[model samples]
Every structure is written in structure tokens, then in C-alpha cells.
Target: MEILQVIILGLCLGFVYALMVSGLTLIFGVMRIVNLAHPILIISGAFVSYWLFILFGLDPILSVPAAALTVALLGVLLYKLIFEKNAAQQTYSEMTVLLTFGTAMVIDGLLAFLFHNTQRTASPAYATDAIFIGDIFIPLAQLYSGMVSLGIIVVLALFLKYSEFGIAIRATSQNRTSAELVGVNVKFVCLISFAIGCALAGSAGSLVSFVFSFFPSRHWEWIAILMSLVVLGGMGSLTGAVIGALVLSVVSSLVGAFYSPAWSTMVFFLALFLILIIRPRGLFGIRTD
Candidate 1:
């Protein structure tokens, strides 16, 4: 029963992790830029939720849409002021790394100055609530987060499948020059994609805050995990991200249950390393070029 409970908990947590990785994967799919600042943007969203909760007693879930919209606008501004300008002058990949790294540092400094280095948590009344099914206990917060993550993934998949702008974004991602030639506004598509990516990050961050305690400088740890998940899933594959998160979570949970908690973290990276060795492009990754 304990093992079963652990597996269920891990899957719920993994779904949240997938939501974070999906944002990174989406940006990579369209722009081929890793956007190292992705974690910083997530932290920014967390802070936004924190402030909103602190100021008005609003639920983190309730504040998520506003935070996501704000982050989306910030993403557009970033694309306009930095990425778009740099893309014109040099290789997009290199510039993306440099610019995003710098942005990450800037965000970290600002957050540290404002929020301090201590851990912060969004503790709602139901944070510690749980449910029992047969002999297993499940956390209510984790279940809620999982459901929200699933809903977001469904909406995103639908958008990409049926929306006109989403189709344009996909076309631009597949072939930017050809897309532009065919009357798609490549620049606009890139900006919109970036915004959508950041918005997803914001929503995920808001949801995650309900489950995890966060410090101002904690973004790097999450960044490393997210990057590994994205790479293991395939640089730009959404479904791959979801699968990678599940695989890593299940592996980590089983290891922690059978071995030591300390080994759980290492297990994820070990799995990632082994997967890369066996399948260089990842489990579901399709070679674009």
C-alpha cells in the first residue's frame, strides 16, 4: 500500500513537472532556443502568485491566470527587445544562451533582493488534506495539481490542433523561411509562441507553489531538472516531455521506496544519462534537420 501510494504521488508530481517542461519544449520547438531563462520566468511567476496571495488572501489557483497573462506579456517584451533583435544579427542558438543566461542572473538578483533567501510557501487551508482509496492515501493538493495540469495539456493540444494562429506557429517552427514566404508572419508567430510558453510556465509555477516550498535562489535546481527532462524527452517534443516526466518520476519513486531517499534525485539523472546513451535523440524525438 505504501509503495502504491508512493507511485500515485510520484505520478501526480510528475504531471506538474511535465507542465514545466512542456513550456521549455514548446519554445525550443519553435525557435530552437533552449531559453535558459525559462526557470527564471517561472520564479517570476511564483513571486507574482506570492505577492497576490500576500496582498489579498486570494487562492494560488485563482491567481494563476492573472500571473500567466502577466508573464506572457513579459515574454513578448523579452522577444521584442532581446531575442528578435539578436536573431537578426547572429546565430540564434548562441545568442539565446547568452541572453537567457544574463536574464536569469538579473531575475535572480532581483528576487533575492526582494524576497530574501528564506523558503516561502503558499499554505492554503487544504494543503495538508488527503484522501484514502482502499489502503492508499493520496494528497488532495497533488490530485488537484494533477487535474489542472491535465486540463492545461488538453487545452494546449487542442490549440495546436485546431487554432489558426496555432497552425501558423507550427508552420513557422517547421520552416521559418518558407512560412514567411507563404505569408505567415514568422516574427509574430515567434513572439506569440514565446508568450504562450512563458504563460504555461506561469500557470505551472502557480500550481506548484501549492505543493512545494520555494526560495528565491531555488530556480537553478528546478532549471537543471527541467532542462534534463526536456532533453530526455526530446528538445521540442511535448508528448515526449510528458513521458519523460512520468518515466523519471516512476523511476525515482521506486528507487526511493526500495532504497534511500537520497538516491531518488540521482536516479532521475542516471536514467536520463542511460536513455541518451541508448537513444541519442530521446524516446520520442524526431530529428528535425
Candidate 2:
């Protein structure tokens, strides 16, 4: 029963991680530039939620959309001021990597200055609530986060399949030049993709805050883990991100349960190294033009 509970808990956390990775994968798919600031954006979202909870007394779940909107706007501004102009240059990807990394450092510095290095966590009344099912206990916060993550995944999949902008985004990602030739606004698509990607990351951060402790500098750790997940999952595959998250989370949880918590992180990185060795392009590599 205890083992079963751990698996369930791990899967719940995995879903949230998958949601965050999906956003990173989406941006990579369309832009071919990994937003190194993704985790810092998440940290910003966490602060947003924290402020909302403290000021307005709103639930973290309810504050998610607000965080998402704020991050989305920031993403658009970033694209226009930085990424869009750089995209026209020959070294767009390399430039973006350095630019986003710099942006992350700036954010980290700002957060540290404002919030200090102390650990903080968002806790609503239901944070510690749990449900029991046949001797297995499921945390309410994790379950809620999982459901929201799954819903976001489903909505994203359907939107890509059905929405007009979604189709345009896909077309642009598949071939930017061809898409532009066919009258698709490639620039607009990239802007929207970046916004949506950051928004997803924001939402995931807000949701997970209910169950996780965070510090101003913790974004660095998360960025490393997320980068590993994104690469091992396949740089631009949403489903691959989900699979990678599940694999990593389950392994980590099991290791932590049987061994030490420190060993769990080691296990995750070891798995990532092994996966990359076996599949150079990741588990679900998509050929981009």
C-alpha cells in the first residue's frame, strides 16, 4: 500500500512536470530556441501567486490564470524586444540561448533582492487533505494539479488539431519559409507560441506551489531538471515530455522511498544520461525543416 501510494504521488507530480515540459517543448518546436528563462518565468509565476494569495486572499488554483496572463504578456514583450529581432539573424538560436540565460539571471537577482533567500511555500486549506482508496492515500493538492495538467494537455492537443491559429503555428513550425509563402504570419505565430509556452509554465508553477517548497534560487535547480526532461523527451514533442516526466518521476520516487532523497536526484540524472546515449535525438525526435 505504501509503495502504491508513492507511485500515485509520483504520477501526480509527474503530470505537473509534464505540463511544464510540454510548454518548453512547444516553444522549441516552433522557434527552435530553448527559452533558458523558462524556469525563471515559473518562479515569477510563483511570486505572482504568492502575492495574490497574500493580498487578495485568493486560492492558488484561482490565481493561476492571473499568473498565466502576466507571464504571457511578458513572453510577448520578450519576443518583440529580443527574440523577434534576433530570429532574423543567422545565429538566432545561439543568441537566444545566451539572451534567455541572461534574462534568467536578472530575474533571479531581482527575486533574491525582493524575497530574500528564505524558503516559501503556498498553502491553502486543502493542501494537506488526502483521500484514501483501498489502502492508498492520494493527496488532494497533487490530484488537483494532475487533473489540471491533464486538462491542459487535452486542450492543447485539441487546439493544435482544430484551431486556426493552432494550424498556423504548426505550419510555421514545420516550415517557416513555406508557411510565410503560403500567407501565414510566421512572426505572429512565433509570438503567440512563445506567449502560450510561458503561460503554460506559469500555470504549472502556480499549481505546483500548493505542494512544493520554493526559494528564490531554486529556479536554477528546476531549470537543470527541466532541460534534461525536455532533451530526453525530445526537444519538441509534447507526448515525449509527458513520457519523460513519468519515467523520471517514478524512478525518483521509488529511489527516494527505498534509499535516500539525495540518491533520487542522482537517479534522475543517470536515467537522463542513459536515455540520451540510447537515443541521440531523444525518445520522440521530430524532424524540423
List RMSD in Å for every model shown.
Answer: 1.3, 1.3
Worst 10 residues of 2 by lDDT: 280-289
Count the clashes in each prediction: 0, 0
Candidate 1 residues 145-232, lDDT tens each? 8878878988998898899988888888788999999999888888889999999988888888878888767888887788779878
Overall local distance difference test of candidate 2: 0.86
Q: For residue 224, give model 1's deviation from the true position in Å.
A: 1.1
lDDT of each: 0.85, 0.86
Q: Which stretches of candidate 1 lie over 4 Å from their true place?
A: none
How far off is residue 255 in model 2, in Å?
A: 1.3
**What is the alpha-carbon RMSD of candidate 2 to the true structure?**
1.3
Candidate 1 C-alpha error for residue 41, in Å: 1.3
